[model samples]
Target: MSPLKPAFFELAVRADARWDRFSRGVRRRMGLARPLRILPYRGYGTAERVLIQARVLEDRFVKPSHLRRSLVGSAIASYKRYATVEIPGARVAVHWGDKRWEGTTDDEGFLELWVAPPPGVRPGWNVVELELLEPEPQGVPIVSAQVLVAGPQAELGIISDIDDTVIVTGVTNPLKRAWALFLTEHRTRLPFEGVDAFYSALREGHGGLADNPIFYVSSSPWNLYEHLDEFLALHRIPNGPLLLRDWGLSRHGFAPGGGHGHKLEKIRGVLGTLETLPFILIGDSGQEDAEHYRTIVREYPGRVRCVYIRNVPSRAQRAVELERLAQEVREAGSQLVVVDDTVSAARHAAQAGWIRWQEVPRVQEHQQEDADARTVLDALGRKGS
Candidate 1:
């Protein structure tokens, strides 16, 4: 069939009707169909023409490259989009309904597929995705969207932690940290079950970005800033501003009590910078996230919307401290919620109307599951176990 008309795949994005109009015009003019594209050439062909197959290459590793370059408007700006997901000896199949779209990746896993809606695809809430057929398991959440006929302009922000949050390397040891990152890309993260869904729900904005901001804050060193994007993308974690620690190595000199205080300072700076906007904070009980939130609540009072603390380790004294902090949070105006895992946090956020939840696979933790949740609580109380 001839190319599918742009109008056929035109779906409204929240809070961007005018921009959407312009976008649709551009898509029509440029014949941009699918926003979803892949890279890394598994099957061999000429540099330009590679076969689009449906299989995951285990030996094949996908790396980032500037292959598909295009220009926009008058500026001859180069497109520097890179593909990081490497499939060894594998290929992906982009299927819509029963129809299949054709494309393939070069050595860099770059697939030059037409960006068009599939045939027989209807309007409103359709599964637009590319499935990794070669790999094991028939169906997985590659990517999907709820296409709407009309929508509004929307923004998204992500609030998260630093150590053991997105990055597996806790602020403990350098060698262990390097091992964690090297073995598992950020995507290989073992986030609390259902976190992927929670993030997706926010990214999709079931409503609009006004309801969410794709911003994230962590107590990690600022040095890891460059790796965050790849890490988040690998794990399919949503994208957002990563609030990192500037103290300790580069610019900010290390203080007496390590960079813990430095991290809190960064969090405070983020709060002040985003003072005018309402936000949500997701963190672990590992560092001073809760304490920082307490400060934020005390300072801004009604500015913060919700606070979710991932239960970790602390003493009885710290537990008492948290209780006091919780009281402060409540008084300042936001809710202080504690959950065992990230998945639970997402649910609580949904139930509490703090955030809209999305569907994701459950993550099973064999080791942490056996550990005592209260052991950390004891540490919080200062009564060392």
Candidate 2:
């Protein structure tokens, strides 16, 4: 990595911050600044400790439209997410049933509070209420962040990647990824079909009764957190804590293989946190997911039950490399199955007795339906053009 790259990136970030501060001041003078809202992300924890992840962003999230979106509308909504202004140094008071804790937002308007779990908290969704108490209370609204506490009966925890594995983001292909990020609406972004069924099956560990926890660990910046969350919920994917990393400021700067260490760190952190439960790691062959997951499988020994590598269509070299890593995973007393789609992974899971054998057909059926719908949509789009 060039030494100047970090310097230049810092310069750009500082410039953007200066512009935001200046523009925000102007908006305030004109009495037109966007309202301050507490944006709390979905968090997960154990019975003893819970993490609360949230941000203080200008209240500018565009409500996603249910009807088919025009390209213009999609572009506008997508751009609004990226252009959000952060409100730093805000004091937020967090409240959970009988417990209370307070924290201040950082320079990026983000807060992560690790507090003792509220007494008598169950294994399912628990609520954490956040109220912005400082900055003179512009309406001082209390917002709820649903935090999942894993139950002891969980057969195994699942850790998944979002981009390419779950959705069709051409991260390796810059132009395609840029279009998907900047213009594609959440409703329009395509998810890997049958993934919902497959994930649901895994989530239902035994006899369709287990309450397994799934955590999505992605290198995609936190700026896209809400978009990704909405996409998961829209597609009926089993929701979990999305552990996305922050943007830029990496030591490698823009160099290839810069940002992916975040995935390894997050994955490891999840495994370490829930020490008793083994994990099933799911990611795509795209970029470094395979490499990162393989590291977990080897390092954690029998802690990981299996690793599923979704084979996204791209360079042949990635496929070959992933095939090679499968042996390493198996040698570590675990399996890394490189599958072409959701159906294949579901089949493997069923055979492994991880999911009911009945779910195989449903996964296959959903995959076919999703593929057919995509074909129809493509044809319609071409004709319209």
Candidate 3:
């Protein structure tokens, strides 16, 4: 399949609008009832304020499945069984620490509210209760979500990409990427070698008291939030708020994959919120991460401590482009290191005093073991094929 261009997405937007209108008309004529459901996603905030977002959708039940399953079976189930029935014009009430914030879902059935955290609301995971408040007598009562509140003690923050950075999503090949996304299960997916250790070390920091916040900014759609969240926990990666994009069509246009503008905006929002702490940016060379990070480093001089770009085979030829970007980042007051593996990144982090020097050897050893495991898995796959 060829890559979709801007014109294709524009046409998709028009088609989607027509379909939506026709569906609404038919539903009205048939007097079909729509079920209501509230889906509260993980949120992030600070001691001063909290940001919470959720979507109102037509009710649909999804059965919980075990993490361990055949890749093909899992992919089939996910693609066929997932539902995204948005219900617009719904009012939602969010309660946290003696405060209640009310907001209405937009045309896309999404609601986002920023509320001040009351006194004595400490850091760590804070649970917020959400209830659908509109359409009297048919509202969802209690749906809870945890929000990570960054404390004042946090020394620095970490912003990293998802696909091709931590997990192996094969973004360079559209066909293979689609297959990995729709045909495989989260448990069956794999992360790059030593990423778990490298990220954990960043989270712990030098004295193990950094309690540094980590934010995962990914181009993946919000629908895959649960899957990615599970992958992180299962692989022992540090937990953080996932900033994902909505892949559906809206009044503006159809955004199949989160555009570069969307990603930059999301990253800027996080940087704006955490004004005091500097950040370490991590991404891969597979996408426009180099360009985006370059802009970030220029826009927020002295705020970005280090920029790490993990090399992908398809992007190897862009070494010159990356070198230029590296110079740009350096001129803007930050270091950009283009490395082929996570162990090198770990070593750099150690030298920069972001992590302990002793952790480097452990990361190196684990990476070697991961490589061996991959060799075995590849051999087994070949035999099966």
Candidate 4:
């Protein structure tokens, strides 16, 4: 399919407005009036401009039952208990520094405003305040979301995928992945071995103070933002802005590609905005990441320093396709490495002078420990059987 155009999104916004009006009419007929709420997800941008986005929803409380230990139970609880009642055609104001931007929520009860940051705003973890101005003054019901601005001192930008690349979400397997997502809590879920060390080394760069900006682009929906954010912090992964998609139905129809278009658009926007900084593209081989990264490498030429694909067992059949993409990436003046583990990728980065070589053993040790733990678990399972 062709890339999504600005007009396409505008049309979607209009459709959402119509649906919101219809839904409100039905609510009125049913004599139901719920309080309005604004749910803003974290966003990222540069010093020049920042993107602030939020969803305006009616307040709907669903009390939780006792937390479950199984993955399926947890997943069901999260989906059923956590509330999302989008309020379409709602107006909200976004304030960052001294500047303000006003925007109305679309059919999905989502509002996104791109506003220029103040001239002297520095990089690293800046907050943008949001307020609801429509549907009878709901007060500041939402907390401010953070926007990470890449500063001039940043050596290179790192755009990484979140699923199997960082955390083991088993994206290649529907059943196992579902179990992990719903059954396990964020704090309990484990990241790939040595991912933290590898990313930390990349963030520090050659001089150990590059403060290189890292942007996490994920196919996961915005509803899971808090869960993923907690996972990142728990694993001590390098912090940055998260680019996530909106779930649920859209105006046009069912999104056939399962958000590949949305992922591509967000990645392209980030690449275009941070034109000066070359990026290290990191993702897993389980999905179309290799395809997307190859397209990015070819599209932007030397702007991409390297493409790292974490090899997964399920995608072993795609080796040929990955090889072809590697050649394409090389021809485009960038390198592509299909690594079996995070340590391999870290070693490559160390050799390239992107990180210190001394850190390689630390990453390897972490990987080995994870392998040992898994082996022990497998042995115990066999014995139990």
Candidate 5:
């Protein structure tokens, strides 16, 4: 914890970034790297201005659509994600309506462009076009990222975690988590029963006509962005922005501050961007989620309507800690709800009038149907063992 240690770590990180940038340039110039491609992430923003994020990288990773089902295949694809070949210092431009903004990718090959939205832009989802200006490709690859803009009628926003909150990752056990993450396809994983229905009901909102947007903030690396998006769609979960972390080491140290610091920072970004719209923060008790939510509640005051913590297997001390957070958040004028399953969350939302009571039956039905599916998923995980 010495000051010198932190200074030394910062120097190491900077050195690593510089080396990576240099080697990547060499690979590209020598025709050793794969074709440079643009990967644009779905972003969330307000009507006045929108925040867009994209990355430039060598397109060497195997496509999820073309991947075969095998431990080796999955492992290879996962390796490609982590062993990223970023194209740093690429000039980029974003266009919205008649407005245009220019930027250059940072040391991590990430570009964050803030551009004004087209005047009189409708809510819901909108698109912004982007293209590489420097280090141009053969055909000038242009891509679009989906930006979720809540309409005036939108009263609330939902920010949920990914790992155990949305899907089964066995995040508490490092081995099992790796098996689930690196050795299985998106279809092979199991979501909590009734999760889709529950989230859909929440998306329906209190007579909002499906305008309430959902933002998924996860510690999962951006390399898995496509797989995660596919999983969400495969499960019929409502789609929105996928806010994932960069796995590479940076100023925040290894793995982009891992779980706690990253999630809170992203949550703050969403709140700050949306301004007036309140939020419902969703995560699981598998880690320090409740603790993080408690901090968010205190920092934001009454801005958070509630914090939903899905119950995951944890040490007894963790349970006691969550119970304490429940009371702490309550005193902050928001509830830190601990739900055992998706059904529990749906029932609570129904009684709280966030969702209609009639939606309860559908959620229950999905829970029962998904019950058997859980066994098959567990078996798949065991096979990896």
Candidate 6:
């Protein structure tokens, strides 16, 4: 790691203090409050350009023992951190919650606002666009992250997939897939071996690294969320928004192209909602994730930082298509990562410096998640008994 330049670090420290003072002054004037301590990960995740998160505060909850009359409690709560930037003299309008909130940036180029979020709004991703005065301004982007109201920390966001990438099922086989889903409905789905610990490492942020927002987007239908949730829980996987394909019922049957289209639409929706914060995408080669991700890279350009693809056995024709798609993905500015298995993928991910080496703890821990998964598989053996 490179040593920080003393001069630059000093400047950063001073600037941070000034920003806080400015925020404090604005909050005082507005009759609101700012956080005294900046607690980490209870708030947001740090990506390449943006740090995004939800609102959380610390509180305590009690747990009861079934056999005993005693109750045990743990301290836990979440906070919501919402701060705004305003250009006082220079007029600016922010579009949020279907209505435009008007404000201007002050002399120090700061804005303060009190936002009451609308109902049904999930806490994962949101955008705040600045409605500028002029039509064609040179080189100034007009969007910022829509964050929480009072929290001093942030959580990192992770967007991933299922089917051959995280699990071993092929989504293309509708009947077989349905049957398999039925058999393993609430049981653990097959993890791609080391994925569980990789996920755990990301959540725990092994070293001084920050935690992130984790999402799962799949071509799977909305009907499968319960089962998918069960699978994740069984594997001890953490949670975020599970974006699913909503293939509406039709008299004849479900549309063939609906899943692909729904997946693309979900990707776009996720992008739009998370316009401020970028994310990492993980999927497999069994289907069109590469091609779809290539298109997303083209559309969003630099928003996509890294892509992890698990290479399943691809048909020759599909192999040719994936090769072409991989090239296109490279051209769009993100790298196309291909891995043989989850262990090798984690090794490559660490090698590429995407994830840290210390995250795995021990290679055997990876084997343990696999071993646990195998135990689940065996427990299912006597299902018909």
> What TM-score against the true fold does each predicted structure earn?
0.48, 0.91, 0.89, 0.86, 0.93, 0.56
Cα lDDT over the full model 6 = 0.54
Worst 10 residues of 3 by lDDT: 59-68
Q: In model 6, which runs have C-alpha deviations exceeding 4 angstroms?
A: 1-156, 204-209, 250-259, 361-364, 368-385
The number of residue pairs in model 5 that clash at the backbone is: 0
Kindly indicate the candidate among 1 and 6 with the higher TM-score: 6
Per-model clash counts, in order, read 58, 0, 0, 3, 0, 44
Better of 4 and 6 by TM-score: 4
Q: Which ranking of candidates, highest lDDT first?
A: 5, 2, 3, 4, 6, 1
Q: lDDT of all the models against the reference? A: 0.47, 0.82, 0.80, 0.79, 0.83, 0.54
Better of 4 and 6 by lDDT: 4
Q: How close to the true structure is residue 335 of candidate 3, measured as C-alpha lDDT?
A: 88
Please identify model 3 stretches exceeding 4 Å from their true place. 1-34, 67-73, 80-83, 135-141, 257-259
Q: Write the per-residue lDDT of candidate 2 for residues 282-361, one digit (tens) a residue.
A: 98877788788888888888898888988877786776787788887788788888888899899889888889999899
Stronger candidate by lDDT (1 vs 5): 5
Give me the runs in candidate 5 sitting further than 4 Å from their true place.
Answer: 5-10, 208-210, 256-259, 377-385
In terms of lDDT, the poorest run of 10 residues in model 2 is: 248-257
Ten contiguous residues minimizing lDDT sum, candidate 5: 250-259
**What global local distance difference test value does model 1 have?**
0.47
State how far residue 337 of model 3 sits from its true place (Å): 0.7
**Candidate 6 C-alpha lDDT tens digits along 191-222:** 76777778765554424244455667776644
Sequence-dependent TM-score of model 2: 0.91
Better of 4 and 5 by TM-score: 5
Write out the backbone clash pairs for model 4. 16-107, 71-183, 75-182
lDDT of 3: 0.80
lDDT, residue 70, candidate 2 = 80
